[model samples]
Target: MWWSLREKRRRKMSSTHLHSQRPKRTMAQKSMKNPRSRSRFSVKTSENYIERMPPEVILKILSYLDAGSLFCFGFVNKRFQELANNNAMWYRFYAGQQAKKKNPRLIDEVTDGLSVVGIQERPEGYWRKQFFKELAGYNANWKKKLKAIHLYTGLPSQTAQILRSLRVRWAVTLTDGKGRESTSEQTHVHFTDAAVTVSWSAGDWPFIDQLTVLKLHGVVRVPLQCPDEYKPGWKSLLTKVKLNKDVWKLCGSDRLVKLLYTEQGITVGVWQEQREIAFIMVNLHYHQLVERSLLGSCVVQYQPAEHTAAFDDVDPEYGLHGYAAHIELHSTAGSIASGRFSQLFCTKDQISDGHLQLKVISKSNRSQHAPLCGSISLPWRTDALQGQIEGCCMLTLTVFDEAQIPFWCVSAPVAMTTSEQAEVSYDCTGESFFVRYEDAEGKVEIELRWMEDHKQYFMVSLIIFLSISKVNKHFGRDYLPQ
Candidate 1:
């Protein structure tokens, strides 16, 4: 399919591309009138100096040429063609391009693990060709899908989720505007700090591949029923993280009015006694309370690798009590899968007395046959220092790995008056593990530099604080801030 499609496209391009761009009175097109005359353009070359150079030197030169330039080099001559199409050249291109992409198919194909048919007996230029072709196909498909589709817009996060829910790739469990669970069959939902994407079986969602998302909605082939309002609601993207019974004491389960994720951060709307919804934004990066208006604030937390949030911070010099998060474990670590990690956290607080209980879990931490390092019960508890805590708070938890290691740590802010929580998840098998942390407090964000690296995985946590935004009092019933 790849070879055939590539040849067909090449034929199409060769027939009309240069012809359409060529001028009518070009020298080459007019040359047929004087075939018998050897016009006057002639330069006698002694030998092909380029081919005289060692092949290794030629390959070195080819390495500097990018994908486009390399393909163009093939048109120069036979030697250049062979050098340009060399496996070494395209392999480097393939490796580099694959590193930037989220898809693993290219890597699998080159590594002899490709599941696709007719990809086995490929030549050196095969990967390089596919790199451009697959990209072209993917982008073109998105463009076609995006043309004239009417999506629920405004809040970018909500828009993405709405489109995802409606354009199913997999069966998803959704609660409609009136709070009814989605009964759609055979669906899967996935989440990350930055995006929430849902996909279901192709057979289930007939028009899913054909559906398009418009960040700014306009005209559409099908009439979409969406009201022009800030429609905020709960979207369950993380399969592993759930609002269990323990944390509900802080924010009642019934009070959660809405949940959505934006590029900036995750925001929530919860019902309050004042007959209004509190708009709270939780910054997952830095794990600090970024914004809140009216109601209680929301914090997003994931179980940390090093149990850094487990520290019991108690200093004799200070008045209030809270714990800081981490102490480095090592400069270099082993594989990302099934191993222990060290995470650190530093927290500052005003309220004085409360024990923080954290629950830790991992969706990929499955190792039934692995040896039991130790028997352990998670959602561990820690108390503030002698009920009298000080300036900076740092906490660390040492979790024993029975099999696979836990990836994130979740805990309540030690002594804050109004503590609320939200769940954040990431696609762990990514090339860039850590997502940028956004400061919700309108403070300058300092650049963090790390010396070491590992396979891409996510380290996400939430920061929740009480809202200082005064209530918006309209002439009568209610008015929420935009």
Candidate 2:
């Protein structure tokens, strides 16, 4: 009986010890019996599930986010902070934004990596800076946002011919009645015998009934047949004009009723020569708004370049056909230090080529200086030469200094057909044609003359007028402050 009792007690004690060793039901497991408690338990366990995901997968997910969202996401955690600040990622993001631009295919085909505005490469933090700049520019209030006002007019056959010969260009400035003004970022105008385009960027807006002013500087003149009331404003070609409240109402109410509104912006075409302006179109919203106001009246048809999606898309097939020529730069006048010439590049539309590295051969080498002189011969019909300028309507030559900065640039139309070659009767002496370009820096004249008969467009001469101010700026001091 004792042995039986002892064995039973031992078995009971062993069972009790095993039960004690087993873990008690956790609070979570105890709550699992209830549906709400089970839901709460799951919520607490999966909080760090994304942190457990593979880094590449997380990045791929984040890639779909915009710049603003990406910036916000950087604050999520340290690991995310590192990924969001990746330069390569931001570059790709910026490139993707560029791809979404209008006619990106053509832009890519022509410029390669060069932007139309001359932005060459994506530097570190450029993406963020551009993003913020665009955001600020586009989202500013009506008074602060950039406004573009375009004025179209017709040129007589005689006036157009004179403009072509003089190579006239216009620079315009817009100031609101309040005195705030903004210069145009880009003044692109394709001058032909028929239509002339003029536009300005407005920084401040004039309220209704205020006098909006336009100050323009150019050498071309159109006959002004203004009413007696408006005669006070019309003067020289380079003069200011103030439009009053009555003229504003007349412009938009009667004449410019048929204004065109497209996805790009609002455009009012007035074919009347007597009409100074048809309407004042202001881009108030992001899309743009067209306000019509008639200045004067007459009907004259004019043909500008073939209107396209973009203004500068003059000829998509320009320079596709091959032509052979020799291009040379000559120092015609003024003085520049020796060894000033470093590189020469030619770009027109989408075509660009680095022509040569120039060496300035001077008669004397001293601390003083000699005539800004250098000659570089670019053989256009060679295996090494990739671009041909034979059929191109226009081309731009940019000369770089020793520091690889643009020292001088000239954009001029090429002498292509016999008509163009004959247009400049004065300059087209023999089988030679000349185009001249002048700016605040200096003047450059390009002489495209034939050598052996008229079989080939043989050679080009670029003569630079080294103005004192330009030379002084190039050398980094006021050497000659004219």
Candidate 3:
């Protein structure tokens, strides 16, 4: 009887388990939970590229960047900083910058007090010391590294504040003392300057290449793009630079100014106050850098632009010459005290060409400060004139101050290029001012405006030169004040 009862209970339990149905999942639960059981899908993405890339790959990539870029990159992230600062990496950079030799293994450059190696080994941190030494302006092998300096925009103290990095464009032409010339290499060194960017590079990579901007002190890297905020100001700064190309401002005797690049060579100027005091015009087409080179000796010191020979004749097609009439001097305006003036006339080619005669006129008349009357002439198109040519002419004038120092000088550029606009006919006269200076014909201009401001600075009567060449019949205009 007990056995029969157990069998019935077991049967009842088995039936219940076999026949019972499971409950259906709700829509919310089904949507929220994984569709498949034991799924390994994750919502997060893995983008740690540095962690993914092999260190050898990273190191091979950092070989192409400049030294300044490498140093700036040292602040990126711990990994990047470490990779950028690696001593081996600097060895490659120093090697690339080194002068070539007859033997691939032997080098003349004395880095870290050692010559080239032949299967020899060096301690770690050796290249790092060598890099810093190059920057310290040592290692005379690269002595021609920096030939000229240009003060582009701001003071050196303001470099970090205004620029993203101090982008140094350095090119050296190697030369031996015996006058042998060599084209070395080009280097663009960038450091923190506020105006542009506060970014750094891992030098330039050898193979892998892409522009990048890493977070300031963060590990996340972002695509480097120019800042929108600084673009307009940058454009304006460029315009300002273009306008004040004449000035070579001398700040101090011993210290050199900042550097700016030009197509021909380097120009040194102060960005603020619209000034440039000195410039070293080097024709790299013919010259090389060395301790005692002809080009190095002839650094173009800052003289009043017009007073100097108007030497920036970049194009043979266009030459600079201009004239002013209706002269006016205001005692309360700028730095012109009592002075004497003289003028010279020469054809475009004759100015630079040593063969032609520069028929200069002398005027030693002493003039008082106010209403300092004078007449000036620049030939319009002098085909009939015996000496003057049509294409261009250089009009040079000298102004001696009360102490006979050449205080005010003019070497105005006049365009006589035979275009339809370069008619023998002159522009309207008695406009109180006239100047045409451009690759093409344009009226009125800048260097003169700067000279006016210069006079205003000294709190003396500013000497005014008026241009009415049309009335003067293109020979010379008399000083007529409106």
Candidate 3 off by > 4 Å: 1-43, 52-79, 99-104, 107-110, 114-482
lDDT of 2 by residue, 120-140 (tens): 245545555554433322222
> Global lDDT for candidate 3?
0.30
lDDT of each: 0.30, 0.37, 0.30
Models 1 onward score TM values of: 0.19, 0.24, 0.26
Give Cα distance to truth, residue 205, candidate 2, Å: 14
Q: After superposition, how far is residue 56 of candidate 3 from its true place, in Å?
A: 9.3
> Against the hidden true structure, what lDDT does model 2 obtain?
0.37
The 10 consecutive residues of candidate 1 with the worst lDDT sum are 327-336
- Residues 248-316, candidate 1: write the lDDT tens digits: 222112332322223232222233343222332222211211111101112222222333223224441
Question: RMSD of candidate 1 to the true fold?
Answer: 28.1
Off by over 4 Å in 2: 1-395, 409-429, 450-459, 476-482
